[model samples]
Target: MRVEYINPFVEAAYNILREVMHGEIKRGELYLKSTSMPVLGVAAIIGLAGDVQGRVLVDMTKDTAIKVASTMLEGMEMEPLTHLNDMGKATITELANMITGQAVTKLHNLGFKFDLTPPAIFTGDNMEIADTGVEALIVPMILEHGKIEINVAIRERN
Candidate 1:
């Protein structure tokens, strides 16, 4: 993905994390991945369409999910998230939705148009995805609680 295509997602994630979790987000160096790698534990996958065609995977560990969910739930106490609970799933999915919605708006301002599908939350140990014929740009961000990977696998629509 071009920096033009990728920056909005990065910026949106950064902004959303800070607002939702109320924590400083540290971003790592961006890298390209040729193959899909194992996700930490939970992933909220949101599909992108219109000008860009692909998916964005917000990947994080179970602990991270619980912590983020708890924060979004107004600091509700949470145990180790063993499975994808409703509140946990809703929080993560909404994070993905907010990130994509904001990014799409930014893209619109830049003369690009796009639409997003609702997010789908998936949970499992070492969960991996198959490459969708497009290389993904992995943007890793660290929060106070855990790490979140914003995997962007988008290309200009043909």
Candidate 2:
């Protein structure tokens, strides 16, 4: 994917995490990944359509999900992640929404147009996200609590 297509998501994730979570967000190595890999424990998948078309999957482990949910809750303590409640699911789903919304806005400012679907939450083991023609570019952002993998895949539509 082009930097024009990818940087908005990266910058948005960094900026939102810094502003919302108030933590040191470290971006890790980036790479292209196939869609067949089983998503960790918790994930939110959002679809994109318009000038660009594809999906974004925000992925993390269960323990990480608990910490993220707590942080997003303004440090409210979260229960064990052996099972997830609505709030736990909403936390990550909203994170994906925030990240995607800001990135889409940035892309719009740069003259790209797109609409995003509501985030779809996925849990448990061995959940697989299908590839959207193009392979996903995985960007790992590490916070004090856990690591978030932003998997972005899109192709310019005719």
Off by over 4 Å in 2: 75-83
* lDDT digits (tens) for residues 55-138 of candidate 2: 899999888888777677765544534446788788789989999899999999999999999889989887777774688989
Clashing pairs in 2: none
Query: In every candidate, how many clashes are there?
Result: 0, 0
Candidate 2 colliding pairs, count: 0
lDDT of 2 at 97: 94
For this target, which candidate reaches the highest TM-score against the unseen true structure?
1
Off by over 4 Å in 1: 75-84
Candidate 1 local lDDT, 1-158, one digit each (tens) = 76788889889988888888876889989899977689888999999898778989999998889878877776454453554588779889998889878988998999988888888999988678877689999889999988999998988776
TM-score of each: 0.91, 0.90
Error of 1 at 122 (Å): 0.3
